[model samples]
Target: MNELLEVLRHQAAHFGPELARTAFQRGLAVTKKDGTRQPIPITATPVILEAAEVRRRCELAARLSSAALKMAEAVLGGNSQEVLLGGLSPLERAIAERTWRQVSRLATTRVDFFVGAGQQPRALEVNTTIPAMQGYSDIAARVFLEVVARHFRYPERALASLLTLNGSNALALYRALLDGYAAERPGQMPETIALLCRRHDAQISELQYLAERFREFGADADVVHPEDVSGDDAFIAHGKTYQMVYRHLFVRRLEENPSPWIEDFFGTVPGRKAVFLNPPTSQVEEKVTFALLSQALATPELAEGAQLTPEELEAIRVSVPWTRRFRHGPTGGPMGESLEDLVATVAAEPQRFVLKRSWDYGGKAVFIGRSVGTVPYNERAQALYGAPLPWAELCERAVADPTGGGYVVQELVETSPEPHVLCTETGVLPTSLYVDYSAYASVGLARQPAWGGVCRGSMAEIVNIVGGGGVIPLITAEVAHKLLMAWKAL
Candidate 1:
């Protein structure tokens, strides 16, 4: 544990003073919904789970996947013709099927191994199409590789070069486009890669980092808002032509503020190109695929094609007991009467369960009946029964309203009491781990075997590191390697 902690600290320090300062600045930006800002706690202590416990967790994860698959199959029947094929164009259906297969395989290969204490890893959501953070993870790994190379004289191998070829970081991606251009044209490498972004300060800062990095690699990169570019040729001002366009803007935001003129400008030009890091298909992210997975609509054909099995499906159902109408509560008590019966069951034993919206995100619209006490429950229940929109109806309205996003009734997961270590300026501070799961996907024939990846960590750590605080680095490479090995074994 001490050795691992030292490694983590060393890794964090290796990014240099500038990166550290940037991380601190970003750390200050951490704010809660209540408008409270909190500094990130940086610790130099290892939070170690015993190897035996880790194995148990992995086993439980497998069992949960089995359960979820079974439930999905029972709902979909033997064929996924309706669930998989419905409301999709041929191309869309093909893509969806591919994604489904990848996610299924990923679930079987990765998710099944993280279970413990009857706690199976349930899918938080499935991001089958246009998954974000691939670039981010790649960048992090690259940063680590760079540090190791510079200081340790680590064999002088070409690991960084190999890794760079596969990564999608802003710099690496632009370089790839240039390399492709050079391949086609023989003598020429594109002079510049234009980054399109909104006029936000944070976006500007990100683009600046990208621009600086691009310059470091002998390429000119500039930040241009959509409005700045002109005509059906949103060409840059310089005599040099843009070899590639990299979109850094938020897709939804850009769509909301459609630069039709800019679109026309780009569309009209020949040989001028653009690549969207996250294209329009990102709307899929808004739909909670995890909730969809638990639904009867997700068929067995879908599960089988995705590489799910009976055992994995059973495990999922057991871990996420709320999915089944018949499953019992956390305290070995019966669940709901009809799921409507669940309301009554929850009402009777408020302490044992909480009402979760079907498609809740970021922990909103989560009503803990025990927290509110019995009197409020009676009032809310009465209102639920009496209102034009009954409780279920109200939940549906909330989900549809774009804020609540429906809800799922879930028994609170009883996490083991463990002291968490938070990295602080002074050193390690004790904290609690709020575990969540993330699913990732990779492309190409090489990536086909393992459709996606799963990573588990304390929620605080994930948020901190993702927000640039460099807290607990995500286990992307570790998890990816594990899944890849599993796929090879299969």
Candidate 2:
């Protein structure tokens, strides 16, 4: 874990200018909601992991995501779409329904997990809509390799070999985009794609990088906003026709802010003016899907009429933590332990679980039982419910929110904290931080893409890049050892 950190502390702390230069040219940054830019918080040293372990987590993620895709289809195909997709804002709901029929497959998804002592990738949530960080992960790995090689004066061929040995999520995303585009338009290859997002969307920089990568991969792509797109007999942007429109914007954000061409451009989707990669999917993105997975074994009916294979069910049992819809009704435990009132069970022992809104973003509606007494959680609870209700009251108030599909109670996955060195703008700071692994996947595409992952570490349990958590690059042990040998020989 400290392989790179050890070398940096002892002999290579002088590569900041070059590293920062790579970051700037690569757009390794996040634009704030208020339209300001800042360097993405990251760790100086990548988290060295076993190749087998990375494969295991990604395999688990794929199974779970495939199960989720089937579940979404079953839910949508059944008579009860609103049972899971209700209570959201009108815009969020419309955004979901607009593309509801378009969800035969999920083009891209990133399943998030916290690592445990036994090496269990305890999944917390699944992001089926607008799954990002592909480009960022590539940038981190590529920049680290480039800077380290340049500083140590390694031969160009050695550096090229090292870069080849690593996987690129950007390449994975590009392949997935093409695969999805092909499925949508058979025999029609997409020469150009439009990366869709809000004008000042926080990940605009990342989208820009993705556009650059797409070009390098021999396809033409442009980062564009809704305002620039027009829908005629076909969707057109800047007088050019794109075969695919990759949406990187969130439904909530789209509902909150949109331009004059929003309705017309979005309206073309049902008619297929142009293929929309990963069409809006608020239904599958809701946190309740975890609860459904938790209950799948207990309630076999949840998997009824859906393609929940035995293998996927086994995967859920092993990796997915216990989760349930937070309500006042009776429900069985994840282990089929006993029937208990959902609200009462959580009220008694809040520390064992986490409360989260069925559908919310940026970790704003998450209330961790472990951190209930902490000031930040309390402040957020007080602000939302008009009082810093004890964990019990908090759960009750959350249950009573008239909103449909309200909150979820999830078993707290005790994360194993590890030491890391933050790669801040100024300098590196060594500290122990809780980290989570988020692996990428594609469900319903012709085939799965070569998906790697992104790691974010933080002092708090709720880790998100935009919410102040820094990223830690994931490096295979073999790759790290190779770099170490190269450094030693130098």
Candidate 3:
């Protein structure tokens, strides 16, 4: 039997008709939202596992993890906090102190792990502030188990038991990841959890599911919105006036518009709080972050403690081709000799490179001189130079103000030609390689920097880019691993 199908069968058996019906309804709703005729976006494509590929991916992940850890320490040790952490901008040392405090506290209770296909587990972002999707995975596993149990009842493993086992496995993975940190902080295991989200009926089901799971683990849990909780409230509940504030706030709402009341509540609450499963700092979701991170002005701290050697930095410079639209040098000046020099070199290589606003995200407001004629380039150049929009201004003018976020000049990477599968209402579509890698990182480092570069935006650009024929995911796996090892050594 298919592993996934089997899991779904077991899930149905354990959850019974009512829960399964609810899940079916939810799936239907999601399909409607996606404007699809089918209730589920089933994957008809076969996932063939090649042992060699798996080993390669795994090796890459390990190497990347090491490199990332080293860079993390350097960046963390310096002033990368201004970029990575969203709020607060004190001196570097002070920021470092506060960040260390936060990290230490979290290290004790949180378990970190990365999940992806093959050996090269794509670098997903850290689950430190708000670890989400665990419950989702659990539910998915249960659903699969149910599907399997309905067709074949061969063993003692019921859907519920399988789900329990899966959940336990996930938790075990988390614990192993955090074993080092937990050993340092003896008694800070996470005991109670508070599910923070917008007060919406749609979210109730998921929150309720989590609450049940937390209860199963013998931990007290509750679901509440930020507005419902006050400084004096002991628990986060809709209709309650109690003791201490909720320990953690799991943000479920995608659009975060903190009203005055909500802000005041969060500010007044004393205990440590995790913002959401995916914090706002993950700007890679936003194309603007990529543009900004790629710019000369943007300095990505490769890791916590490791600095890119001159050679590595040079390699990065070489990777990015020059363009004229957002060039920084004089029109007729000689090109630069180093990566830093290319900032000026771009102006000279008008045909080879595209000029973009330093703050623009996605392909918006990007002037591909090669695509446009000389006449158009001259006209746009006049407007751009006449006004000479600052980075902030350029960002505001870009489509939906993609430039307002940040910018970078990326030398396009060659994409693979292999065909892949995509699901549609009609049937499965055979597509070519077009997926872009949006890598995430969770590093164990000492501190957060006071003033440095960090990218903030949505991952929509990456998805769009991938949809638009851009393939090949780029990750700093070597950098990540180095940072991890360095921290471990320390």
Candidate 4:
């Protein structure tokens, strides 16, 4: 552990303090709605995985993606429509009904898992729409691996033989665009692909990176804002017409305010003009989908003649934690008695549950039953739910209230802390943190989905890069083994 810390310190020194400051201020710091900002943590030491473990996660990601796609199809197909779509808001339901004319229900997804005692893997959540940081992982891995090779004098071939190299999400996205084009146009190749974003979006760095990468790979890709494109018969951006538009903004926002821009992009301009990467459907992005999967697992008959097979249902059941989408009452609130019962249950065992919003991202609107102290929990709950009954009641009410439109309660899987040190701007130092095994799965041109992943380490209960958590490049098990051996030999 100490040797790994030393390696990280060396890497941080290589970047220098000036670059770190610039990156943190310009890139890492997240600006909240009230104009408050905080730096995003980054660790030089990476989370290492066994080759078998990498394969297992990849396969698991594929399965989860398949399950989510099936669930979306089931909702769209009217099989248990109310049961599957009941938990979503009106806009979500409307979008879920608009069948993606060209793409899969799930174009891409990220399965976040926590590996507990005896290496039992339990998925926390499935990020079904526009999962970010795929390209970041590739860049991080390249930099870290290069540093490791330089410091230890390892040959390129040896590193290549050990690692699961080439997980460029930018490439995967480009291919997915082509697949959508082929589906819509049939044999006619798309000449230009536009990476669409709202005007003055913060993710300009990522957009530029992906655009250059797409161009490098022989695709005429350009970063264009929605304002730049006119809602004409043909979608034109930057003086060039585009066949496909890769949306970087959330569909939920678009649904809130529908515009000619959206209609033109989605081919609602008389006839279908351009293919939207992730058609404005936020239902698949909601956490309620997990609850639906859990429900389907319990009642196989619910999936009768559905796209999901019995075996797939079983897989989803074991992989996802026990979850339920809380339903609202007729008087515009949670079911009163059921909410009370849920509060009582949380009071009995606070550590077992976590409440999350259906459409929130970046660790916002999350309440971990175990993270708060008894007094604080009650106070927070009371503040949130108009007078807290008890810690348990607070937990229950937290899940019941649809403050953010909808909510879901998930069984909290214990994520044991691992021994590690912080990779800071100053230097490396000891800090115990929990690590989350997260994999990004995308269905591109290939028959089998490709998987790239990141392992986030955080002192906070929720491990996310946005919440002062450090991201480590997830290396193959074999490469990790060799690195361990080398460290020991040293």
Candidate 5:
């Protein structure tokens, strides 16, 4: 562990005074949620899971996400569709009901996991709409491997086989768009592909990187804001007409802030012509998908017979945690028990569960049971609805607001602390961090297998990059040794 710390110190030195922070900020271009670049706070020691184990988790994620997609799609035709999708807003539910033009449920997504003591990987959420951080992950992996190879004698060739690149995600995304176009409009491969997003998106750099990659893969690519596009059935950019367009903004935002461009994109000719990357289906993005999966696991028949296969059901039970849409009625538990009973149980042990919004992202509105004690939890409940009666009142509030914008209560996953040394001004400061493994899922002809993934660490309960935590680059022993020697020489 000390030797590994040595390598991290050396790599940190190589990046200049701030060490990895400088490289991360400039090289990786880590951006905050406010569209400003800041110094990255990366841990020296990376959590190195076995290559096979990483692949297994990734495969599980694919299976779970695919199954959830099918289940969400089933809402359009299923008899219990209304009850099943009661958590989504009417607009989101309506959007989900329609078959998207050429595109399927989730073309590109991400499954976040936390592997704890038993080494069993527990999935936190399925980011089915717009998943970021792949560009950073790709660059971090490359920098670690390349820098280590120059300074250390490691099995570079073998390691390459074992690990996967973040580039696969980019390739998968572009391939999905092109293939969808091919199927819908054969023999007319799109010459230009445009990435359409909001002007102030913090992930602009990532979008730019993907656009550059699309160009590399033999297609003209452009990154433009929503307001940039005008006219009928075509987006005009720099005097060129873009046939294929990738949407990075969510449907909720478009609805909340309606403009001429937004209205045209969702309502008029352009909405039908320009191909959306995600196709505006917000149901898949809802946290209720996990709740549905949890419910299905409890009562397989609740899946409505032929909608989900036994294997798919198994995947849900295996990967997904116990979840339920927070609502204001007498909800049925997985085993047909009353929701009131579940609430009573949760009240007895509030620290074991979490409550969050259904369709939100960036870790907003997440109320961890342990993080916020009984007083704050109740205070939050009271804040939601002017008065606080009891735990039952909160459950009622959740049920009352069962829409696409509803809230969900999920079982809290306990992740084991990963030992890490933070490289700082004085020296290496030892600390323990809770790490999360974020695996990217790409839509393609077959399952796009992922081996290695982006690992982020945080001292706080939440391990999101936006909250000051940063990426961890997994390297070998030889590389660590060289870094130690290099640091000593310095």
Candidate 6:
């Protein structure tokens, strides 16, 4: 591993320019809402991991997704409280159940994880909604591999032997969509599909990338915004009725406009109108969902509700960190300490935990106690708490309304920082950044694909791409082994 990093760094000049050119040519960029285009942060450094590690994380994501799936099934089968506790609004609940009844499967999702001390893997959050970056992973790992392989003078055929992009997230999602379409409209294949999102969404580039790939994979797919969506008995975008729809937009975004067509299109899901690739999943996508998964392992009431098997429970016990819905009143700590009020305990000893809104994205709602004094943390804390409270006040404020289900407290899992070279269009620079691994999983797909992990690194504890951290492509250990041997031979 050390040898690979050193060799790549030593040979930067030979491959850096091609890497910059490849990024632009392939459209590997994300947009701001204002439509300001920026290169998706690329780090030439690709984190290599054992294939088993990748498989475990994906399987764990699938298990929890299955837990969410069972929870969704329970809702479809008539129990709605679990999703409500997972933070879906009543209207959101109605939408989720309706969609779940129709779609009946989870197509794609991403699980975020951190490898803490002793190399213990801790599951942090599940990104069931818009679990992105499959395309970006392909572009990064494949591009970096191709460019560096060229620098190493490897022949064209040898390009693929170095690293695997896990059959590409786009293809995995494409296959899942096909299976969903078949399940919904058995014996029929959709001629056209729509990747729906709000116009100028931050992930526009990636959506476009996926749309094109879907088309390449044989589904005539288009990236469409809600405003353009129209239909009565079917989904009509750009005057064509798409038999399948992959909604990349959130319900809140849909509610913002609430046009008649948007209502008909989504509000009437899993129907004759079209097959939803990703059903309304905010129910299973919440941090509380994982908290419940964590809580279920210990609390029999939740355990019965979750219906996880012994195998699933064991995995959660080992991989899912200690977490609970953060609220006032009696609670137990990670070290078995008892407390009358979790809020007060957290306020008193803020260093041991992290707080996050049950439903949030882009790391905007994450607050780490150990980072209290730092400007980045302090500024974010001030914005969230209406003025940075003393640590105790911050803790008190972190607790959410139990009735509505708002916050989750997690035992902090400190991920180690390692050396990485940040790759950008301008140039590449060596730096040490805190990075975490994310594995993508598809629930309800008939055949599972080889899904490699995606990585993000940042200067702060909260590592998110939208927070301005960069993406590090992951190379499987097998590929790294081969690449290393080939490098030394050269």
Q: What is the TM-score of each candidate against the true structure?
A: 0.50, 0.94, 0.47, 0.81, 0.80, 0.92
Q: TM-score of the candidate numbered 2?
A: 0.94
lDDT of each: 0.40, 0.77, 0.33, 0.62, 0.63, 0.74
Please give the RMSD of candidate 4 to the true structure: 5.3
lDDT, candidate 4, 379-415, per-residue tens:
5455556664555555556555655556777777877
lDDT of 3 by residue, 259-317 (tens): 44444333321233322111222222222222322232234543212543454334224
Q: Best by lDDT, which number?
A: 2
Q: Which regions of candidate 2 deviate over 4 angstroms?
A: 1-5, 8-12, 16-21, 259-261, 264-271
Q: Candidate 2, clashing residue pairs? A: none
RMSD after CA superposition, every candidate: 10.6, 2.2, 12.3, 5.3, 4.8, 2.5
Q: How accurate is candidate 6 locally (lDDT)?
A: 0.74
The worst-scoring run of ten residues by lDDT in candidate 5 lies at 158-167
Residues 262-353 of candidate 2 have per-residue lDDT tens digits of 55455444237777767766677777767787778778898766669998998898888889888777787655667558788888877788
| Model with the higher TM-score, candidate 2 or 6 | 2
Candidate 6, superposed: residue stretches over 4 Å from native: 72-94, 97-103, 160-166, 400-404
Winner by TM-score: 2
Q: Rank the candidates by lDDT, best first.
A: 2, 6, 5, 4, 1, 3
Whichever of 2 and 6 has more lDDT, that candidate is 2
Off by over 4 Å in 3: 1-40, 44-101, 104-132, 137-142, 145-191, 201-209, 233-235, 239-405, 410-490
Which should have the higher lDDT, number 1 or number 4? 4
Rate residue 255 of model 4 by lDDT.
Answer: 56
- In candidate 4 the C-alpha lDDT for residue 270 amounts to 14
Report the lDDT of model 6 for residue 486: 69
Compared with the true structure, the alpha-carbon lDDT of candidate 4 equals 0.62
